[model samples]
Target: MDAAAEPVRRSPPWRDLLAPGLATLVCLAILLALGTWQLQRKAWKEGVIRQVVERSRIDPPLAPPAAGTWDPAADEFKRVRITGRLLNDRETLVHGLAPGEAPGRALQGYYVLTPLVREDGPPILINRGFVPTELRNPRDRAAGEVAGPVTVTGILRASEERGLFVPAPDPQRGEWFNRDIPGIAAARGLTEVAPYLIEADATPNPGGWPRGGQLRVDLPNNHLQYAFTWYGIALCLVGVFSAYAWKRLREVA
Candidate 1:
């Protein structure tokens, strides 16, 4: 046991020496299983995309099945038609939205949320889309009338929340924008408001702030991509393990 080769110390478990060939095979098997799982996920995501696409294509012949805390199974993706007058008097424009509709590089606007009183029941909140900041000041909308019996065709959508970065709005001071249906209905003095809101189809609005009807359905099915990355890492690990084992076998020989 010279100083250069002082028994080439290794721990008890490391020196025990499991079969490298077996370990390499196990690593390969694990990688393949993960890749297969990813393919399955891709199929599932594709099915979801198909369902949503088909739902949006149809006309609003059928009504949304009652109004409550939105059952995804019962009410989501289905088309509905509502004919009612827009209550411009009590409408609350949630601030901050602009597709750069007008001049001045700043895009400040409000989403047009008017309470549409259904003939039989309480008023339902209809988001008519976004309007410019100039139109949202109440003074402008208060003067303009969204009068008469108008028809609206759009998809049923749930109200959104302010995320960690975005805090809940203070409607009293008019300092925020999010489609909080409960908060919105309270702020606008709208009684019997529907729990859900409609993300409109490509329809035009008057004041031209929010550029309404921009209902985007963009969801990526990237399970395959993700799986590929993970499997690639597994492959690299297997390759490295194989090379190490080969060197060890040569030294043992």
Candidate 2:
């Protein structure tokens, strides 16, 4: 065959590449979109983390706003001080997991939610802190329950919604799966209770049973890593399609 005069090699037919080309384009679009979405999420998550730190770390905590006065979006995680008598007798234990002694281990336990009876406004629910499965009973940690007028300084939190997998609370057994504030108030025969809970700070109690400071400020932020992963996959996909198209065109030629 003459080098220049012989029949010139032609590219693959449009029909042959159309379906795969369209499929590849669709996949690339999805992958790129996912990666971009992750970057946006990264920015949003960073803002949330910053807000939590700023709000929760304010010194000389302010008093909580009255009913219908506070906006949860604006006031959540704000450091607040409330002085009242803790109704230890009506405390509710919500199931949870706390950091164990060893690293990367979790201890099965419950958060003690007790009502703080203020003199003027409605009583507020305070997440006193975590207690292991062994100290689930108030009697076991009786001395820790300080009586009389007491002041609590901690981060304000909104009511927690139950997860789909979470079971309904056993009122008879006084066991709760999640922090349903209204349910706890009703069960405790409390009226006009505050709509939020306060996660107490790391202040040591007398008996040192119900450990305080359970706010999970350090939220998992792996969106950037996820974005890179998606982009990497998209790049590999493009390289594979290019190789496949090149092979097909050469075969036809």
TM-score of each: 0.75, 0.93
Candidate No. with top TM-score: 2
- Per-residue accuracy of model 2 over 79-100 as CA lDDT, tens digit each: 9998999998889999999999
Q: Give the backbone clash total of model 2.
A: 0
Positional deviation of residue 191's Cα in model 1 after best superposition, in angstroms: 2.6
Q: RMSD to native for every prediction?
A: 5.2, 4.2
Instruction: List residue ranges in candidate 1 displaced over 4 A.
Output: 1-37, 68-70, 95-109, 132-135, 138-145, 207-210
Error of 1 at 175 (Å): 3.4
Model 2's TM-score against the true structure: 0.93
Cα displacement (Å) at residue 121, model 1: 2.1
Deviation from native of the Cα of residue 210 in model 2, angstroms: 0.8
